[model samples]
Target: MKPAPFEYAAPKTIAEALDILGQNDLDEVKLMAGGQSLMPLLNMRLARPSLVLDLNHVEGLDGIREESSGLRVGAMTTKRVLEDSDLVRSQYPLLWESTVAIGHAPIRNRGTVGGSMVQADPASEYPAAALAFDMEFVVMSSAGERVIQAEDFFVTYLTTSIEPGEILTEIRIPRLPPGTGWGFQELARRHGDFAIVGALATVRVESGLCCDPRIVLFGAADRAIRVPAGEACLEGAPPSEASLTVMGDAVFDAVEDPLSDVHASAEYRRDLARVLSKRAMSEAMSRAS
Candidate 1:
């Protein structure tokens, strides 16, 4: 299938892009980053926009910068760039693992960081990683820029808090404290396939007790979510098999409405969530120690 007829614009500057967006009804204007996700939808006629505003030519929106707080990543930065970044690999291993897990090398070569976050696919790794790391999304429009917390950014499947006419410009990730350990796990049919279920965890062991533990899961809900119930189960608790089991049970119970698709049943997804949560937490604890 071919895409519906649409006007196309390649803006070299964000101001130019914003001007175009302001003139058109947002529903009729679709923003194109890397086109990895949107191209398929366009080809299928699922997205019938009157205007496809391409951002590829836009400058200054594709790099990684170190900040005192942590790192500031441009939204248009490609996944391949992220995967190959030594700073990312050393300072944010969890993010590095998640980046490598995305589809294949070819897809990563063109898929933008902002594109995946805006796509809001429940099975995607970035959303879960965003929540686990408490990342912040920076969006811009004529009104100016606003930062959205990860917990509030993702609203539902294929949906986000980004208002029409707003463009995602950057993602802010905070630096992990010393001795913090992280883990990422996903179950996919193939090595590069979308995960059927996935879990991400972070832990800091203090005096033999888990401190500031976080557990996030994707492919188990309409959006990636942080499991406070699961986190509560592990907070201040010894990083033991028994504690992990209880935390896993909490994570399983928290996923009340696991997505049911042809790939997996709701029951199966919930079980995978439970199992993966335990494994991820165990790995995080081991690394923390």
Candidate 2:
């Protein structure tokens, strides 16, 4: 299979890209930063774009900058670059961990952060990372720019709130609060395969009690879902086996009717969600404490 015939353009500036998007926005104007995901889709004939917009020469769309609020990551930042950056490894270890969990080395070498989120695979780690970290996505378009919360960004599987002619510019992640813990866990068919079940947990621990508990899961449903009910079940409780079991049950109870495929059965995936979530939460709370 091959994608339908398409035109290509490389725009150096945001304005130039916007001009292209404006003209071809409704004409399957595909944005191409890296060929990691789009190439495959194109070859499989799953996505047939009339125009491919290359964003390489688009400056200011790559790099890691820090500010009083937290980390501001350019959309075009590569997974390998983020993985190698000392600032990310030292300060945002969970994000670093998630980076490694993305595809294999070759894919990571060229895949961009923005592409991953824009692709919006339900099992993809970026969406979970953004939701787990409560990040905000800044999108730019001819109409102007607006910030969309991560929760709202992921509208459904392979879909996002980004409108046509809009490009994701950057992601904003708040600095980890003091005494905060974080963890990322996923159960994939293989290490690099799309996960059948995954979990990301973050919480603030104070005086030996959990506060601000947050647990978000991926790969078990159509989109990533925050399991506050599961988190609430862990409130004020130590990470004991009994407490974990209860929280795990809550997650399992909340995550039912998961999509079944060759990788796993719906029931099995839901069960894995419960188990992985508990382990992730335990590790995250341990680090927070």
Candidate 3:
């Protein structure tokens, strides 16, 4: 089925976009970036907004540049560019690896980073990467702009803290400290399908002991969730096989109610979480040393 008849607006500037959003209630308006996900919803008649704001023509929202904080990625920047960026590959290899797991080349060519984050899909890879890195989102509205930490941005399944009249403008990822090692792992039916379960890990080693370890899991909860218990298990501990197993178990146990659908059962998801967590932690440990 085709989307319900709706008005479309292409704003050349962010200010104009914000103005449009300010004029309409969120229930009546929808923002369109790559349209990889939104278009499907529209075509399915699941979303029937009165106005659709096309952000493709919006200026100053599609570039990547270096900043004192780390990398400043415009919300409209395509996933393909992110996967191929030299800076991301060299400095943020974990993010690059995670991006590669998103859909396929065709989808990545048009899918925007902001779209995936805002969509808040439980099976998406970007949210897991964002959680591991403590990424910050820059949100803008007519009132002005505000920075939101990744943890706070994602409120629940397909929900976020972004209010009406607000749009996600940028993503800021801090540089990983020296001795930090990272890993990303996911299981999918096919190379480009959404992950049945995904895990991302980052570990810092000092004096042969693990420190500042982060373990994030997706497709196991309402949103990307950090396994603090798992991370705590690694703190000050040697990154050995036994420790990795324990950490994975902690993560697996932390999942409250694993979502079960036609793709997999909750029991299967829990097992995947355990195994993937171990693999990710082990890879991170190997790189840390």
Candidate 4:
């Protein structure tokens, strides 16, 4: 079915878009950037907003920039640009590796980083990567702007902390210091399908011991699950087969409340988590070494 009849506004500037959004009842207004996710909802009549505020024509929301802290990507930047970016590939290999697997080339051409994060699909790759890297989001409203850490931005499956009147303007990724190693792995039914289970591991090694290691799991929880128990097992320990074995077991046991769906059973997802955790951590450690 086609979407319900709605007014469409394509604003050329951020201020204009904000003004349009602010003037309407936020619940009745929906923001459309890439429309990669929203269009399907609209086509199904799942989202029947009164006004669709399109941001494609808006200026200042389509570039990648490097900052003293890290890299800043405008909300409207496409996934394909991210995948092809040399800076991203070199400085943040995890980001590029994860993004390159998001979908087929055409899908990536139209999907935006902000759109995917705001969609908040539990199986999404970007949100999992964001959590793994401690990324930040900058949100704007007619009133002003505020920054939100990735941990707090994703609230639940298909939900986020974005207030109705606010727009996610940019994503900020912190620079990984020297000695950082990262790995990303996902299990999907097909090349471009949503992951059945996905894992991201980042390890920083010093003096032959792992430090500040993080393991993030997705497709097995309401949101990306950070495996603190897994990290704890690896931290301050030599990155060895024994440590990885222990960490993988801890992560498998620590997985809690995974929902069962047609894609897989809870037990199966747990097993995947256990297996992928070890694989990712091992790859990451090898890179760091």
Candidate 5:
């Protein structure tokens, strides 16, 4: 199937793009980054926008830089770039792992970081990683720019807090503190396929006790979510089998409504959440300093 007729614009500058967006009805305008996600929808005629604003030509929208606070990643930066960055591999292993787990090399080469975040797929890895790392999203519009925390950014399946006229510009990832340990695990039908269930964890071990643990689960609900109940179960607890079991159970209980799809049943996803949570937490604890 081919996409329906639509007006196209390739803006070289963000200001130019914002101007075009401001002049049109936002609901009729669709933003395209790498076009990995949007193209499929367009081709299927699921999304028939009147105007397609392509951001590939927009400058300053693709790069990775280190800052005093953390890493500043441009919205158009590809997943493959993140996978190949030495800085990301060494310092942000969680992000690196998540990027690599997303599809194959060809998909990674064209899939943009911000595109995946904005696409807000429940089965995608980045959203779960965002929550685990407490990342911030920076969005812009003709009005101005604002930062949205990960907790507030994701609304539900294929939905986000971004306003109709806003474009996600950058993602801010806080530096993982020293002595922190991270683990990422997901179960897919195949290695490169979308995960049926996934879990991400970050923890710091202090005096043989888990400190400031974070557990996030994807492919188990409408949106990737941080399991505070699961985190609470591990906080200040020794990294013991018993503690992990409790954490796993808490994670299982927290997933009130697991998504049921052709890939898996709700019961299966809920169980995978329990098992993966324990495995991820155990791996994180083992790596903690």
Candidate 6:
């Protein structure tokens, strides 16, 4: 199938892009980033838009910038660029790991971080990373720009707080605190396949006790679910097998209503979520020591 007829717009500046979007909104317009996801949907006739504002030509939104706060990535940055950046690998190892594992070489080459994120796939690893790292989304519309927390950005399945005529411009990742260690784990059918269950655990151990540990789980619900119960179980507990078990159990118990896809039943996914949470937490704790 081919996409329905649509007009295209290439804006040179951020303001220009937003202006295009604002104008097209009057006629049901859509924004096109890398076209990795949108084009497929267009080809399959799943989405028919009257206008597509191509953001590729938009300026100042395609590189990584390091700052005192953390790393700020342009929305147009490709997955391949992220995976290859030494700065990203050393500073934000969790982000690098997630990028490398998402899709394969070709998909990574064309897929943009902003696209994957705004696409808001429930099983996408980046959303979980954003939540774990406490990332921020910088969005703009004709109304002007404002920042939103990662957790609050996702409103529902395949839906976000990004409103009409708004576009995501950058993601702000804060610098990791001293003694912080991060780990990412996923259970997938294949090396690059979407995870049936995914876990991201960051443990900061201070003075031989768990402190500031966060275990955020994805691929288990309509959106990413942060297992606060698991993190709480580790709080003030000694880094030992018993604490680990309690943490894992808490993560399993946290998911009261998990989704059931044809690939995996809710029961099996819940079990994987438990095991992966435990394993990921153990590894994260080890590095924190």
Error of 3 at 60 (Å): 0.2
lDDT of each: 0.94, 0.88, 0.91, 0.91, 0.94, 0.86
Query: In candidate 5, what are the lDDT values of residues 51-130, reduced to their tens digit?
Result: 99999999999999999878999999999999999999998999999999999999899999999999999999999999
Order of candidates by lDDT, top first? 1, 5, 4, 3, 2, 6
Write one digit per residue (lDDT tens) for candidate 1, span 1-289. 9999999999998888899999999989999998999999999999999999999899988999999899999999999999999999988999999999999999999999999999999999999999988899999898999999999999999999999999999999998888998888999998899999999999999999999999999999999988899999999999999999999999989999999989999999999999998999999999995
Error of 2 at 207 (Å): 1.7
For candidate 4, give the lDDT of residue 60: 93
TM-score of 1: 0.99
lDDT per residue (tens digit) for residues 161-182 in model 3:
8887889999998888888888
Give the per-residue lDDT digits (tens) of candidate 6, residues 30-97: 78888888998999988899988889999998999999889999999999999999999988888898
Runs of candidate 3 exceeding 4 Å displacement:
none
TM-score list, all predictions = 0.99, 0.97, 0.98, 0.98, 0.99, 0.97
**lDDT value, residue 81 of candidate 2:** 91
Clashing pairs in 1: none
Residue 263's lDDT in candidate 6: 84
Off by over 4 Å in 1: none
Better of 3 and 5 by TM-score: 5
lDDT of 4 by residue, 105-147 (tens): 8889999988999989999899998998899999998889999
By lDDT, the better pick of 2 and 4 is: 4
Candidates 3 and 5, the one with greater lDDT: 5
Residue 143, model 1: Cα distance from true site in angstroms: 0.8
